[model samples]
Target: MQVLAAGGDLAQLTASGLFHGASYGALGAGFALILGVTTRFHFAYSLTYTFTAYAAYSLTAEAGLPFWPAALLGVLAGTVLGVLLELLVYRRVAARSGGDGMMPVFVASLGVGVAGIALLQLVWGSQSQPYYGPSIEPLRAFGASFVNLDVYQAATSVVLVLGLAAALRYTGLGRAVRATRGNPGLAAAQGIDVRTVYLVCFAAGSFIAGVCALWYGLQYTVDPAMGTRPGIYAIVVAFLAGTSASPLRVLLVGLGVGLAEAWSGLWLSLQWTQTTVFVLLVGYLVIRAAGPLLPRRLVGKGA
Candidate 1:
């Protein structure tokens, strides 16, 4: 029984990992927009994700609202907050600092993330808040088990990933985003508002993240620190996919990451989940770093 529960079945592990990866894909989709388009990152963006979940949790738990409406409103609040942070805080910092570099922006983001998590703790306490909404029953088949929520989560992530890719490829805003990502200065010269693109990315990213957060609230528990670890993993996915790549590629990379972690669970303990991600990241970085110096044939370059 213990062996079966761990990683006995490859099919089971792959199914589980794909579902887990769906959440990562949703998160990476949001973060990728900002990182790829605006060329700015906020450690605090994950805080926005947490804030979205808590907002809905508060409405449902405290105000006695239904789960769906509360979640919808929570998404609005989070989206607004994200835009505000970009407009009020990030923009002002950039203006004040004269757009010198990313260092100031990152510092400011880290500071906000710390402060935001602390505030969540103060207001909500340190308890893990789980939703008691409509129970999504577990589904079982092919010697595997999963929940209906996992299906919804995966479907939603797939739609969003495809939507994002289509928008970037075919829409007016997509053109602007691609242009800004490629060369902000040239984009501005072409009459694109780089700042507006940044704002839009924040709003869009935050909204998508909020939706993803809502799924987490339904399926799992929420806490002030809920977004911290997942946020780190999403950042890794964003980098792995890179700026200007197909957003659907983010989904594929996320699935790969999930597979790696899930397979690792076959032998490793539960506590080692995060370590797997970091190990993969480090391995990728090492290979890239060495690729330049290795012989062309060995590196598979000029082939």
Candidate 2:
């Protein structure tokens, strides 16, 4: 009877939103890890995502491998490809066009991304690749229904996020990554291989992207440009969480955003839901930017 149930019941929408949000958490956290640590904008991450999805689809549909194995192999291939991008393209540019990277990093990333997109389009064309990996039955509970893939995706995200948090909090490698993120120059001076740290971030980030690609292709269709929206959303979440935000915090923020997006469907058309989410994000950013300039209220009715 509530307004939020105009299109569907609250329970159904909430269930869907929660699962969708879990993917967002994973995507956002991965982007943040690389961007925060490596200082690379990584526009080419979309290429990695697309390639991984297609690779998995090929293995499953053409090679006759099971979905899980295909996904794992595809993720591995994508991870290697990402590391190659870092080592072959980004690192070389950083060396040649050095000076606190006035503009070269941006130019390099943009160029590589464009070139990669063109190549993919040339090879795969603009046709959407449908995934026929597995047959799934919708599961229902509490008057809500969802598929098994949703639960698997959410569980994987939660487990990985928690493991990442623990590693960042308590491990020696974590301390090194923290130090490098804080000050690469100081880290290099202290005998920390800053380049190695960057490499690690890229590998981890790309591996996450591959996992996302797997779940995404399974749930939806795959296309060369499929990564565009997810990539943009991940960047927004990373910035929304800010430089100081913990990985767990990023995941929580993503979940909250997912819920907001779902609730927004109560009033807007499905076509406009994504746009509304960005509008809301912009409003939040404006308020955050203005908050620091505003004066605080006096406590206890006294100055």
Candidate 3:
């Protein structure tokens, strides 16, 4: 409270909160596409998708390109890398398992993560590179100040989340995904191409994650290990939301967590700030894990 009241660090804290929300939203979207519903090669694709975005950002920054062009190239390269990973590595592993068990997929994702990090290190030389671009002009409105870039990034995340939710709810593609996730065999019986749906979902998730990578690069320095932290946080957020289908819920959770994290860091130390997220994750997990263990009559007899 004293630190926040001091006011000197408020702006930086606000900016960090916005960026953290965006990162969490992006990561949540990526993992949700796999664990929450899609639950297959989608996870593997996300691994590749995140890795490709990191690699592209590193390449562009190292090459001295402008931000917009670099972002464009990064997204394009990410899409291509996503496609290749899906078709080559994921397809082969899925074929071997005949899409029956999850262990093979999990192992394959680990392999992909290792390979992706190694490739990034080889190309980017394992050093953090400065991400240079136009400084965000801050504006004050209604007694609240915000960095323009943070506002823009948060707005972009909201738009993407809404667009994605709408597409999944109203579009034919969305129906196919729901069907596949609900029951692949039944979806196939109804003439839906399950494999195609899986591929498209993976691609879409990766694309969103690529956009997130660009925003992150704009806010922070690009590094080979950048995705690891965000990726873990995203997983926690997704689970905390209880596999929520609402993108709004996901966005809100991200933003709320971001605010909490920022507030904690301001009041405490930076190290405790990181620990707070894990603490929240563990607390949520315990509550969830205990839900089924409680007596049913005591759990919800009146409700």
Candidate 4:
């Protein structure tokens, strides 16, 4: 508390944390969708976002394309690639492995992530590049300030989360996903087209990734490994947020994480940012794990 009070700029740090949290929340929800429907935790998902950001950047900065066109192309490329991964790699592996295919799928995603980085290096030369886009001035209020880009990014995340929540709750496609998630065999028997659900979910998740990547690129330089850090935090947040289908919880948790990370810099070294966040993850996992165990133990004692 003292450190934070004495810190160079508390307001700026808080604002930074909020923006970072919003990004993490969106990414976490995206991962949660894939996890809930497909039962596969894709470690390589970050690569898709990073790659799309780079692709969009290259299209606009190098190929001389308009911003929206380049962004559209990049988003399409990323979504298509995500669907292809599901159809080509994960689907085949799942078919072969049957009930316990998650491990195999995870391994394949890891491989994909590595391959993505290598390909990025091969094409983009592993150098960080600036994002080309329209400039916006900073917005300030009550001694706290942020750029318009930050506001856009944060707003985009919140809107996407709400939109996803609405789609999942009120749409036919959402019903198919919920049905498929509940029991694939039953859903298939009911002619829910489970495979289609998987494909759509994966593509949707990837589309979110691409959108996030565009904003991320706008805020920071694009590089091959840019997604790794945020990816880890987002995945952890998804797990911490539990099985609730609401994105609002994820958004709150993401903000908490961002606050913790930003405030840690006041008292801890810069290198401890991730470590601090992971500690929170570890603590949450332990507490959640204990929840079920404690109930079972109480039941046993009562019996």
Candidate 5:
């Protein structure tokens, strides 16, 4: 109430929320791809992409490379790392364990995440550094201020997400991936190379993660731990959207979460932001869980 009365600028908040929501949606969609197909919880994905952004920013800022080339380098680095991990580590584990090697893969992913963070600390000394791009100046319009870069990022995210979703729905690669996800053995028996699908999925997810990292880097400083919280939130968003949910739903859920997070900051202390988000998540889960039971209970009572 106090913030609103003091000219809180709802429009600005809305724009920020949309931008953040798009970011989260991108993260969620990527993670969903990896999770849905691989069935391996990739904890390292967050840090991996963050490292890519940091490395790319450093290349551009310190190495004197142009932004596009630097960004491409960052994305390629992340994608290669993801594909290598899948091919060298997870694939070997799966081969040894007969494709149910989720435990080894999961543990290895955690170890890799820790190693990535430590390596980043050693190289960057845990400092937060800004990207080399021009400072984002807000464009004021309709009695609201908005950052043009942020809006551009949001648009890019949405388009990429929609495009990926469409590809998954209509393309042959998408069918192969879906087939592999449904049953690797059957897919393999049907002449679809499961390994190839896995490689594609991992690479695609990693590329999306890299894009997300770059966009986030544009908004804030690049730090070793920058992706941690958002990564966790992305997992939650993925679950909320469900594996079979459409891309638009996932995007909408992400946007809702972003809006909630941004709006809460106006009334609550910054420290309480995560707490509020989790509380809302829990409340939503409880409602969703109980919603189905209510109909059953009512039928029983009527009977």
Candidate 6:
């Protein structure tokens, strides 16, 4: 509380907070969509979705394009890669291994992740490229300087969360997705084309992840292995959110985690910041997994 009150450096804190929040928000959304819509190959889809966006940003920013254009290109490339992977790889693997069993799919996803990272390193030359396109104008609010990029990132994240929530809550496509998630076999029997739904879900998830990558790249330099940490953190956030399929909840959780991390970094050492988040996630997951064993009234009673 004292440290926060002192607010060692408001400008740096705000900038870091916004980027971290935005990055985690994108991750949470991507993982939630994958888990909600297509449970069989969520990890594989996530890996591709994240890495493609990272790659796109690296390629475009290195080429000296504007940030928006670079971000757009990243999103497009991620969408394409996601669709291709779904059609060419996951679809075939799922078919041969029997869709009911997820082990083969999980293993395949791990393989894909390994291959993807290797390929990324090969093409991107394993070097960190500085991301420079446009400088964000600074503004003063309440006697503290704030970077425009922070506001932009925060706004974009909020907008995406709202838009996604609206689409899922009030759209026919959303209904189809829910139906598929509830019972893919039943949805297929009803002529809903479960495969197509999976494809679409993967595409959407990838697109969101691409946006995350673009924003992340814009703030920090691009590196071949950049997606690993954020991807892992996203999966953790999704798990902690209790598989609720609520983007708002996920966004809030991400932001909370971000703020907590920022505060920790301010008061503690940088090395301990990530450690604190990991501990929090572990504790949350333990409590969550134990919920089913507790009495109904005790579970989530106050939360």
Expressed as tens digits, the lDDT of each residue in 136-228 for candidate 3 is 787865445666777777777778888888888999988787777778789999999877886776677677777776666667766777777
Better of 4 and 5 by TM-score: 4
Name the 10 consecutive residues with the lowest summed lDDT in model 5. 1-10
For this target, which candidate reaches the highest TM-score against the unseen true structure?
1
Task: Please report the TM-score between candidate 6 and the true structure.
Answer: 0.86
Which of 5 and 6 is ahead in TM-score? 5
Q: How many backbone clashes does candidate 3 have?
A: 0
lDDT against the true structure, per candidate, is 0.83, 0.80, 0.69, 0.84, 0.80, 0.72
Question: How many clashes does each candidate structure show, in the order listed?
Answer: 0, 0, 0, 0, 0, 0
Cα deviation at 34, candidate 3, in Å, is 2.5
Q: Give all TM-scores, in the order shown.
A: 0.93, 0.90, 0.84, 0.92, 0.88, 0.86
All models, RMSD in angstroms: 2.4, 3.7, 3.5, 3.3, 3.7, 3.2
In terms of lDDT, the poorest run of 10 residues in model 4 is: 294-303
Worst 10 residues of 3 by lDDT: 41-50
Q: Summing lDDT over every window of 10 consecutive residues in candidate 1, give the lowest-scoring window.
A: 1-10
Which structure is stronger by TM-score: 3 or 4?
A: 4
lDDT of 6 at 205: 76
Better of 2 and 4 by lDDT: 4
Error of 5 at 298 (Å): 11
Lowest-lDDT window of 10 residues in candidate 2?
294-303
Estimate, for each residue in 86-202, the C-alpha lDDT of model 6 and write its tens digit. Answer: 788767777897746467767777788778878877876688776654586877665456667666767777787787778778998877888888888899999898888888877
lDDT (10s digit) by residue, model 1, range 1-303: 133355347677888889878878778878988877766677787899999999999999999998889989999999998888888888778777875746677889999999999999999999998776777898987777888888888898888888888888899998898899889999999999999999889988898888888888788898888888778978988777664567788889889888998877776776775689889888767766798787767646422
Candidate 3 residue runs with Cα over 4 Å from true position: 1-15, 41-66, 98-100, 140-146, 295-303
